[model samples]
Structure formats: C-alpha cells, structure tokens
Target: MFQLVSTIVIRRLLVAIPTLLLLSLVVFVVLRLLPVDPLAMMLPPSATAADSAALRQQMGMDKPIPVQFLIWLWDAARGSLGNSINFRQPVVGLMVTALPATIELAVVGLVLALMISIPGGVIAYVLYKRKRETAADLVVTLLQSIPSFLWSLLLILVFGVLWPVVPFSGRVGQEVTLPGITGFAMIDLLVTGQFQAWLSALSHLFLPALALALSFAPLVIRVLRSGLIDAANEPYVEVARLRGLSETRILWRHMLKNAALPTITMIGVQFGFLFGGALLVEMIFGFPGLGNLMVQAVRGNDLPLIQGISLIFCVLMLAITVVVDVLYALLNPKLRNL
Candidate 1:
C-alpha cells in the first residue's frame, strides 16, 4: 500500500509540473496583454514619455517577451518571485501572509457546507421516497436556481444592515487583537484562552462563511441525493433489507456509506468553485484573504504577484485532486487494483 501510494504521488507530481508550467505561461501572457500599464501604477500621471520608457527599462519590462518569461521562470525556480510592484513587498511574502487566511476561510466554509448538505441531502432522499415533490426538494431547487453572489448581497442587506445579527465585514473587531499564531483567528484565540476574542472572531466569520456555504451547499446536496438514491437500490442494500435489517440500519450503514464516496468526490471537485467564490466573497466582506490580494494585484497589473497566486492556485488544485483520488481508491476497494 505504501509503495502504491508513493507511486501515485510521484505520477501525479509529474503531471502537475507540466500543468503548472502551462498555467504559468497563460497567466504571464494574459497579464502582459492587458491594456493597463504597470508603469501607470508606478509613476505619476504627469510623468513624460521619456520617464515612462526609462522606468520600463529599469524594471526589465523593456526585455523581449520570451527573454522576460525565461528570466521570470528562472527567478521563480530559485524561490525568488520578485516584488509586488504595487505593494512594494516580496511577492512570496505577500502570498505566505495571505494564504493562511484564505485557507482558513475556505476550510470553515466547506465545513459549514458539508454540515448542512450531507444530512439535508440524505434526509431529503429518505423523505422523498415516501412523498414526492416535498417542500425540502422545492427549497433545494430554489436555492440552486439563485446565484450565490445575489444571495450573498441579500444576506448582507438582511443580516448586516437590518437586524444586525453579525459583523458585516472583516475578520474580527478592530478593538480585539489576538496573537497571530498560525494566522487563523479562531485557532489563535482558542490557544491563547481568549474566549472573548474567539467569540468576536466567530461573529465576524459567520456571515461570509455562511454565505460561502450556502453558495456551495445546493450542489453538494444534489450530488449526495443522487448518489444516495442510486446506492439505496444496489444489490447489497437489497440483501441487507431481506436479511431482517431495519430500514434505518440499512440506509445508514449500507446505503449512506456507499453513497458518500461520490459526495466526497464532488466536494473535492467543487473546491475550485469554492475558491473562485471566495474571491468575490472576500471582496464583499473585506476579508484580507488571497482572493482579495489577487484582485488588488490584477487592478495594479502586478505581474509577479498575479503569476505567483495563479501558480499557487493551480498547485493547490492538483494536490487536492491527488488526495481525492486516493480517498476514492481507499473508500472503494475496487479502485485499489487500478
């Protein structure tokens, strides 16, 4: 099993290298092709043509496209991603600081999404078998039809503006400052025994996390429901039903377990969507995550920052895919042979 896992990891890494390289090239080309000039970001509006040319030359933007790409790639290989033209900080430093926040948000949001989606989907399927066209089904359909960002806006208006149940934007209250251990607010707060800070952090996290969860929950539910329905009709489930097993026992032990494989796979696949949604969600709530940093980089035409972030995202996706594949293999032993 260890050998198998190692072989899988090696093979996946081999594929991931080229995939990331292609992604790097695409990001590099797209940023260069954008009409916005990075020089405009660096210089004053009154700066003359000569000044612009000189600045471009000094920054090595005057190099040929292929030459520029080769130099950037070489620097990247050496763990030097250059500096953020806008923030004037090391691109790697910016990513390191921002990555944890984004990861924390995404993990929390996924937890929230799974917490609701799994049970909701399972119960819905169980109930639907007894009665078709139930209210739960309709609710799922309605939620799926509405755009996530629109729901985010509505949530902000209702919860943030009207009732004021939770903090509207940002990670924590301005007055509350906890140690940045692990750069995860909840973790840091708990580790320091700062319950008040923890509560405040939860309050700030609730809305954005809820919004992100609601956005992805419908898809998760749909996938789970379909998988549950199919699994319930399998031969093993039929055998269990005939062997004097209770309906609940058969459903939970046999059907749900088998059904869960697909749902888990779907969760991994939907990670990209979750990450993409985080970009808008972070911007709307003023959360200082990688997505927000990415948005700022784009507006400033920060090539190194953009390339770094994009490459990071591509690497993350590839790593996730490998984990999901391994999980699928473990859950369904038939896949182990492959």
Candidate 2:
C-alpha cells in the first residue's frame, strides 16, 4: 500500500513539472501578445519621449521578444519571477506573502462548502426518495444559483455598512495590529496570541465564505444526488437490503460511501475555480490576497506579475486535478491496479 501511494504521488509530481512549464509558456506568450506596452503603461502622464524610451530600456522592453522571454524565464527559474513594475516588489516575494492568504481563504471556503453540501445532498436525496421534498432542498438550490459576487456585495452592505458587525475593507479590523505569520492574518494572529485580530479577521471572512459555499453548493448537490441515485440502484445495494440491512444504514453507510467519488471530484474542481473566483470576493471585502493582487497587476498592465500569477493559477488547477485523480483511485477499488 505504501509503495502504491508513493508511486502515485511521485508520478503526479513528475507530471506537474511539465504542466507548470507549459503554463508559464502560455502565460508569457499571451501577455506579450497584449497590445499595451508594460513600460509605457507604467510611465507617468507627464513623461516625455526620452522618459518613455528610458523606461522601456530599463524594463528590457527594448530587447528582442525572444531575448526578453529568456530574461524573464531565467528570473522565474531563479524564483524571482521578476519585480512588479507597478507594486515595486519582487513578484515572487509578493506572491509568497499573498498566496497563503488566498489558500487559507480557499480552504475556509471549501470547508464551508463540504460542511453544507454533503449533508444537504444526502438529506435532499433521502427526502426526495420519500416523495417529500424539504424546504432545505429549495433553499439550497436557490442559494447555489445566485452569483458569488452578488452575495459578496450583499455581505458588504449588511455586515460592513448596516450592521457594523465586521469591517469589510481590510485584512483586519483597523484597531487590531497584524503580525505577519504565514501571511494568512487569521491563522497568524491566532497562533501569535493576537486573538482580537484573529476574531476580527474571522468576523470579516464569514459572510464571504458563506456566500462562496452557497454559490457552489448546488453543483455539488447535483453531483452527489446523481451518484447516490446510481449507487442506490446497484446490485450490491439490493444484496445488502436482502441481507436484512436497515434501509437507513444502507443509505448512509453503503450507498453514500460508494457515491462519494464523484462528489469529491466536483469538489476538487470547484476548489480550483475558487482560487481565481475568490479574488472578486477578496476585492469586495478588502482582503489582500492573490486575486486582489492579480486585479491590481492587470489594471497596471504589469505583464510580469500578470504572467507569473496566471501561471500560478494554471499550476493550481493542475495540482487540484491531480489530487482529485488520486482520491478517485483510492476510493474506487477498480482504479487500484490500473
């Protein structure tokens, strides 16, 4: 079992290298293809022709396109990812600081999703089979269809403006001093004994997290429902029932276990999407994260930052898919020897 798992993990890591390289290439090419010149975009409005030319030369924009790519690629290989002309910080440094916050937010959001989605789907299936649909199904369906941004907007209005229960526009409440631990303010503060900052950060994160889960919940429910329905009809389920297993036990233990594979896949996919989607939520709530950072980079036409971040996202997606694949193999016996 250990060998099997190790083999799978190493294969995934090997596959990830090329996937990341391809991602870097696509991002580099696409950004270079953009009409705006990064050097010109970064210059002041009052700059003269000489200033523009000097800025272009300083940014290596004057180099041949192929030559410029080598420079950027070399920096990326060295873990610098170049400096952001807009932020005036090393791209890698900025991401190293912001990435953890985004990952934490994604984790929090996915946790909320699973907490609500799994049981919601199971309960809904149980109720649906009995021909007595509950209000939970209706509510869950409704919540899932609404856009994430709309929910974020509503959260800002309710929690930030009207109720004042949470501060909407920053990493922490203004009064609380943040200690930069792991770059995830909520976790860092809690670990460092800054309970006030921790609570403040958590308070602000709640509505957005809830909104994200709600937005993605329906699809998870749908996937699980289909999996459950299929599992219930399997010959194994019938055999279990014939053995005098309780229907409730069969439903929860037997059928649901078999049904979880697809649910896990969908959940993983949503999480990959969440890495990009959460930026809007982060921006609306004034959270400093990769998504917010990407938005800033895009607006400033900071090509290096944009390319680096885009590659990160592509790599993130590849990693999630690999995780889901391994999980699927683990949960399904047919996948083991294959």
Runs in model 1 lying further than 4 Å from the true structure: 132-134, 336-338
Model 2, global lDDT: 0.81
TM-score of each: 0.94, 0.91
Residue range with the least summed lDDT across 10 consecutive positions in model 2: 128-137
Report how far residue 158 has shifted in candidate 1, in Å. Answer: 2.3
lDDT of 2 by residue, 188-296 (tens): 8889998876888887677777767778777888788889988988999999989999999999888998999989977887787677669888888777889999999
Stretches > 4 Å off in candidate 2: 41-46, 129-131, 134-141, 161-164, 336-338
Taking the tens digit of each residue's C-alpha lDDT, what string does model 1 give over 255-326?
Answer: 887888988888898898888888888899998899999999988878889889998999889988999877
TM-score of 1: 0.94
Prediction 2 TM-score vs. true: 0.91
Say what the RMSD of model 1 is.
1.7
Whose TM-score is greatest here? 1
